[model samples]
Target: MNFAKGLILCGAIVAASANAQLRFEISGVGSTQIPVAVASFADEAIAPAIVSNVIKADLERSGVFKVIDAGRVISETSAVDYNEWKARGARALVVGSVSKLADGRYDVRYKLLDAVNSGELSSMGQSTAARYTRLAAHKIADDIYEKLTGVRGAFATRIAYVNENRANRLYKLEVADADGEGTQVAVTSNEPIISPSWSPDGTKVAYVSFEQKKPIIYVQDLVTGGRRVVVNQKGNNSAPAWSPDGSKLAVALSRDNHTQIYVVNADGSGLRRVSNSAGIDTEPQFSSDGQYIYFTSDRSGGPQIYRMPATGGNATRVTFNGNYNTSPRVSSDGKTLAWVSLRNGDYGLYAMDLATGQELRLADNATEPSFSPNGKYIMYATEAGRRKTLAVVSVDGRVKQRLTTNAGTIREPNWGPFMK
Candidate 1:
């Protein structure tokens, strides 16, 4: 935490070995719930799990669809029974099939049928390696979601987070699916790791590691396990935020005096301090347009969110309602801003509509809000009973889901971009 303000946020971080799989417990229904029936895919038993089941889970977790039982195995080639599906209380029916090829790839096909209208809404085919069965299902879900709701789905994206196991004295940075599966350890260290920011292209991650007994920023490639130090000045370095183009990074460096925001090239060169504030200025996040950089600063007697030119000039405060607001994050469309605000002694996730200046609180006791690729949901670390878990709330403050794990502490969650 760059100049900690007595707030700690934890997400759905998994541990090593047997504790890798993250579990989710979603609750609350949206105002409008379209009932969708997903049929069992033929030959999908060869997949990691049932491909149709994964599709059902993805749609259900979005809080936009209520899963209805299809009651039998149905493939994309099956004859349409729109009236039958409508009798089953399903507004839409999803049928898919999966076949394993001789070359060790799976061919998955799906069609979204409008039961009420008795017509086909959408159809798609995805071929993937045997290992990416879940990913294939996610893509199908994304297509179905977009066809029905007119908003791009974020189910196919990935999420990265920091896991600190104080009991075993282990620290790890891990990446997983947005729904918390397919775990991959990016980097591990006995020292702490925090503030993971995904590259705009979803190929790399920029984070702060304390392996050298001091904070330093490092940009690590997700595909290859190679990494290079982006910032390691005389003092502490933390809170690395990637630019929209992925060419440069805005981070907090304490080399000058108090922790201040600076821009640096991804290759660890062309470092220049951007914010010239006597008060600590940190947590620099670039806007979606790359025209401005939003950050947190205490220049106004207390920490408040601010925005300045991407190259840094006069900082204008963006947050006015709260006296303490930090961890500023803008949506992918650049129309919404999400940040952590301290209210009633609880740090919570708050979002503001940039066009109308309207604000709404998302989740209480939450911090570190990261907008999904489509900007439809905000993922953040929040308190769940006695343990810390991750929760995803829709930007409209309607749908909510709680993602939990069996053990370990979770922190610093970052949602990845759309790979397609």
Candidate 2:
């Protein structure tokens, strides 16, 4: 009856936290990510100092603000002497206190101060269950990110992925809040679901399901629990990638004898070819602008990334580093390309600047990286021992964190677009 059951019969798997008036009033994107100093919260009787570290990690990972390293601090105090923080080149300071609520909850408060002028900029507070203390810290960071960047921080968005239990031969799809809460099954099956991709609008997901014993692509609406077959043609109907506008889907189908990239209507019409390489081509993704289609092809001698016009053009090779590169995804802004690279005898997430052709390594042995809509973060699946879990990291390759529940082997994570 639920979406999760649909996936199991076919094969796959699949909240919002409480409403808080998350008021964000950030100043303009200052000339730079203002340098800020955060003192470690004392009195574990109040809140754990570990929360301070989490907050620091979130701010630093944003690539927006420069946080003063507490490792350099020589004193622990409640009142910040502005000159000390200013001497460390910090323009802002955050001071906070935490207290226990009778309900076994935590009341956390933080105040942002302009170290430059020694004035209060903004203050925010949050309450959370004791187990969610780390999330409380991330919420503080989200408030700061929204205030500064004018975009909501994804610190609270969940990543959905598939997990496999080989012994039982079961596969499960699961979801958890951004801070790793309320993890529940999206779907599960004896078969497998691969390449789960969120539609640009964030209301539905298109994925490859093996419920009928052959790989077929289906689009499932998150709200109505309704699904439509997107592609079920012969010979490997895998890799369903949605276009930026959600008007079309790019997929790899071998119906014509060779696996190649094809574009079709998201509603399952207007099928067309985007790549026609003599060799196998799969994993077709659209550039952020939707002007170009990028895919993996052995047409370049081995699996490598190539780009062509969305309307079809001479394919141009984009990756030159590794002997094999596949599953290329362009960021929302079309500025960076992230893909799995088989280099150094391992598969990891490698990013390349679309304009400069410079590569930045983001993760190790990761697959199916779905970029957040804001283009600031990436969620991908990786193996820890035999189990796969979803790992999220900033675009700059810093601040890596894992989101997992009791369900084992999470794979093929797709971060949905920003949804209210």
Candidate 3:
């Protein structure tokens, strides 16, 4: 498939703002929910309500903050009445302002305050295009979250998924913000598109597109909408996994008649076999350190996750608790392993501590799990009632949120890397 020409011919670059906004359902709540009050910004001409709404929704959906209703509006530049907020049981308060700039842009300024201590936590200012108001709001939320929690926030990241319109036999590869906003279709085709994987730098995506009546891997530039077929051999070529440094890809190829693991350069040259197993070896993911490659194989009689040296060596079994385990994803810190496991006749998501070997079950009836860039949550695709929806769970399994769209079936979600 000539991916560049195919994307142009199919008209896949769809406007995200034209589609339906994703609706979020909070399934589980955390035990300690911090009460936060976000005051309305000062300016009404720049649509400050839209910015505040996005910030409130982001913190609320994370299950970490309870957005309290600020009874009266407060000016962003005015001093905050800490005693009033403390009486309302709010621990933290967020106040901001939006102003129309002289150069046809918007200036957003925000402050994070500690209500209990009556002190200022942090403050920031940003200037952005009027069209990117929501994105600017998300950046403010990320800053507030990091200041309060001491962990880097992932609110500024993005996610990629496949939206299949079975009725028209059309598939669209879409990208959206982490909160399911700013949806943009990158590519579209009549054939199936699956396994959307983001590049380490968040500029490109590698995915399997069956446009030529067979599985072929393509890497597309997200900025220019230009794409090239990286792996198009005679037989099945699928599951393109990016290495840590973004110089090479680990893919599964059946050109030799049996699916095996192979490492290929980013430009699709110097292909070298990594696994010599007879059983299917696929879904290869490189560790954060790039020292080992983790993959799923049935060489042990049943599908299980195995790890081999990045330079190719003996494979060692990593998952032993179940007969079936696949889609292994390592955390950014390289201390945890998350995968899909079948236990008690039910398939669920599991995470294991690499050092202690202790495992924890995250969710039941979940598939295609992808960890957030900060390793705080795991997003997966599952069936809600009869419709397929996307859900996210905290790593500790304490909080959960489900995201559903009014569009057709949604599947194969891959959380993008952190924004630069």
Candidate 4:
């Protein structure tokens, strides 16, 4: 639980570039989408539609906003044209400008206005490197979203996932923006790589990599691209899940001849067993309060979700609707539990309210569901046609988005923590 140990490990990992950019398509949208219009920036000729387009796309993909045509919106910085926007059916309007600074940076300023009231809601400015124009745009979109929706925006966050290119016989660990843009490979090898759990601070990820000829758990620092083997025990070291405090990881290991949940320090010290079961117990995730660990086990003759103390003790089963359930992930508030459940031979993602015990099925044929930092959406890998792709569904099951890659299969997506 030492911060210094995580820092030391951070300095030892190396960073790498990603291989492909993930393309996203809105497979489904919310029934009631707020109509919003994004006007072209003042200096559009400088970057054309880069910033405005990215902002528009981000909002639209959330399944909560319907982006109006930019051609009909005025790009002026002066008074608001309430009648014009209202005629276009836009409830909210966003206007911004992008200017180049003397230091080679860009000044991106934006304003969120209530079109109906002809009033300014919020305005902010940011300066970023010329190369990070798109990221700067995402940040602005996030700001606008929060100002309008009263929910923290997740647009500025990143995602880590494993890509398997069977044609090239390569397995890659990749990171990209929440919109699936600017993808960069974090690690690549001929063997398989999976899990990919992000650290609490969003700077590091712990995943199971088979590059060493066995299931080995590695903690990779995203900033430095440096990596260290956190668990290289004899049998199998896999399924690494970071604790909420980022000081320890709950992992499933079979070094002792059976797969059981164990807790290990961030620096790979103080390893202790957390789950004791004769059958396989794996995929341990810590609750937001850091008091209980949720996991999947077959000790009761079938795979189901279970919970126990973080320090290891008596276990309690949580799921009762289905005989097969696994990959339990607790929400940010620890009020909801999301996991994969098998129904009629089809695997689907389901969320359960811990307090009410009411269950809601989110998506069918989905696996590896991880909640967004704000607990609004759950991202998981699902099948798209003949290939596997990444998808996201709102916690309410009203909004859905699918991210498809041009080549290879995508799996094991872990949404990162919110950006600082």
Candidate 5:
């Protein structure tokens, strides 16, 4: 049996080991890349390898500057010979040092230098517990990203997902640091948990749970482990997507005898119908501006994505190429949408421009794709035989990586915003 089919029958299956490692590398294809070289910390540094690689990865992922391979670095400190670096075509240089405190904590200090003029650009430092060394590195990356791109970096965020281990009959809702470390099970249950969407505040996650033997929407608080059912109507109360303000949720409900879009307050009050067609109008997602809600509907024919004003306006069709499109996730800026589009007899992750309606495929055999809080990368579900895993793809559709643990089959990854 197919792995996905077995997953439904067995209600969560152990997946095989993933064949990939999640790492960052940039080939620097474009001519517009700012040439930057990051050198490994001195051998005396405390978190030597971790900090250097994390900074390199963060810079490469930013898509603004090209990270020069360190294979040609002439120095790794503020005393770098600018002439040598300039000879190698490096425009910017980064050097850092890490120190382990007496309490076993770690402090990372780094400086940016303008290679051309050989002048100090900026200097910063961050401290973290020994366990959060990776987070400290991400923080450094966030600082660099903001300084360069002027947009806040999401390197310090987290991702939550549901994992199923068929052999052990185990199901767990897992949360991990955005860089895929510090994983802990948020909830463990025999029933399935699906559709984990983060609240705008990054404090809560709204998902569907089958713990009551029926589908119900649940909002789970991360810090306190407090949870309550948001909506548990008679049928198909699935896909709880929070609006931008965290005040309203656009959900799909079948309590009216057909699946339709419904908007209700976060407290479950002011329940109002938003879609009234004779079709399945589900998977409702609110635009970042909150002026409109985009959803999956089949009123025209097979399922296609549509957008309607948040206050209820005439619906507008957004997708025309695929026979099926679902799981629409709008970016934080509301300019792009990442979704699953079935084309050429295969389901792949795609992004569509809302203004021009131009669509681009991001990944193959990918579904249920969710965008990163910063809208730079997308995490989606991919299956091969009995193995299901989460795959992360660059928003520009260039880089891809797969993540899986020996513990279970991973599915339904939802990226959360950077926690303040």
Candidate 6:
């Protein structure tokens, strides 16, 4: 990872390796992981949802917890066998149960315990619709993770991606659970759909559609299933990125000059070009505070990352290490930057601490990187053995996992924010 091949302008769907059904192929290990046990929910075998299973899967996928004793029946009220779990090297234990309510809803309950101290750490229960059982399980996992790891879990969030069906020439914009389950199609067309960006509130998504033989930006409401054209100019209106406050979208438009960055109101008003560079500038991502825009440009000889005031003037180079760097993604805290840098001969994912300038390579052959709400992980599309797949890596580059499907190629993954 020391040299560059060439400048790749378009971020297309790179073929990946996986099955028709989406599954997680996790690899690598963290420097440290908490040892815990997630027991089977008492009487959950009689319910339609296996609460404990979902909780265990979410915790394990995070690479923060090593789950054991998942088949043993346990409930929040059950007596804790501290000696047994402590002998098994368990630092913490989780117990939960799901039961039908008289109102036809379901109640999911869970509790976290300290195996060493033999005391309850936390407990929570939620009454939700029958269909939200999986969501509840994810919520429970989030709680357990926060209690044990001191970091909020992203399991309750969602992901938006483009699923390509090349055989039918069809493209679908879909949103699914964090674990790649419960997919719901938001938009579909025979033409190509690229660069899906989620609104900050998680209620809408803006993307580029080539429906009319050209790229047009459109924003769709996930709740209402209604979409409206946000930017349908004479030229290309692609790479729509939302402001941190969800009031505006910074996009790369070819309407004025050579694909300069522009900021427009979320409702398609007040369109104004922001970049004044002679070379092409695109992929405008807003800083966490919505103060500046991070974009790629060829202004200084080779494609490199730069930033400028969100409203307009004074561009400054941000990526000086690479001759070819693109897709600058600032973490939610505005402390780190993630980008795809050409290294050796392949495009790879890299993260840099803006404060310390310490850079770490997250993955090789990765692109379209998006950060999770908690800033703990970065999800990006990458080529895994010639297949189109989506993978996530911890900011420290310690934990890595791939989400792939044999059903079709899924790319342009945008990890959504946590809902209110």
TM-score of each: 0.95, 0.74, 0.95, 0.93, 0.86, 0.93
Q: lDDT of each prediction vs. the true structure?
A: 0.86, 0.72, 0.85, 0.84, 0.76, 0.85
**What is the TM-score ranking, best to worst?**
1, 3, 6, 4, 5, 2
Q: How accurate is candidate 5 locally (lDDT)?
A: 0.76
Error of 1 at 28 (Å): 0.9
lDDT winner: 1
lDDT of 4 by residue, 1-420 (tens): 000000112243233434457877776777788899898887844652378889998998888888996573345476777888899999988888888889978888888888899888888888888768888888888887888788888998999998788787777787888998778777777877888999999999898877767878988987877888898887888889999999999999888898899999999999998888899999899999999999999998989899999999999999989888998999998999999998999889999999999999999999999898988899998998878889999988988888877758998899999878
Q: Distance (Å) between predicted and true CA of 151, model 4? A: 0.8
38-99, model 5: which lDDT tens digit per residue? 88765324563467788787677656678886653332354678887788888877777787
Every candidate's CA RMSD: 3.6, 7.9, 3.1, 4.6, 4.8, 5.1
lDDT of 4 at 273: 89
Off by over 4 Å in 3: 1-12, 17-19
* Candidate 4 CA-lDDT value: 0.84
For residues 1-420, write the lDDT of model 3, one tens digit per residue: 011002323333556654555667887777788899988777734653377778888898888888986755555678877999999999998887888889988988888889999999998898888878888888988987898888788998999998888888878888888998778888888888988999999999999988888889999888877788889887888888899889999998988898888999999899999989878988999999999999999999989999999889899999999898988999888988999998897779999999998999999988888999988899998888787778899988989989988888888889999889
Residue-wise C-alpha lDDT for candidate 6, range 215-250, written one tens digit per residue: 899888887766789998878788999999999999
Model 6, runs deviating above 4 Å: 1-21
Model 2 Cα lDDT, one tens digit per residue, 135-169: 67777777777766787777655556666776787
Stretches of model 4 off by over 4 angstroms after superposition: 1-19, 70-76
* Cα RMSD for predicted model 6: 5.1
| Ranking of all candidate structures by their lDDT, best first | 1, 3, 6, 4, 5, 2
On lDDT, the stronger of 3 and 4 is 3
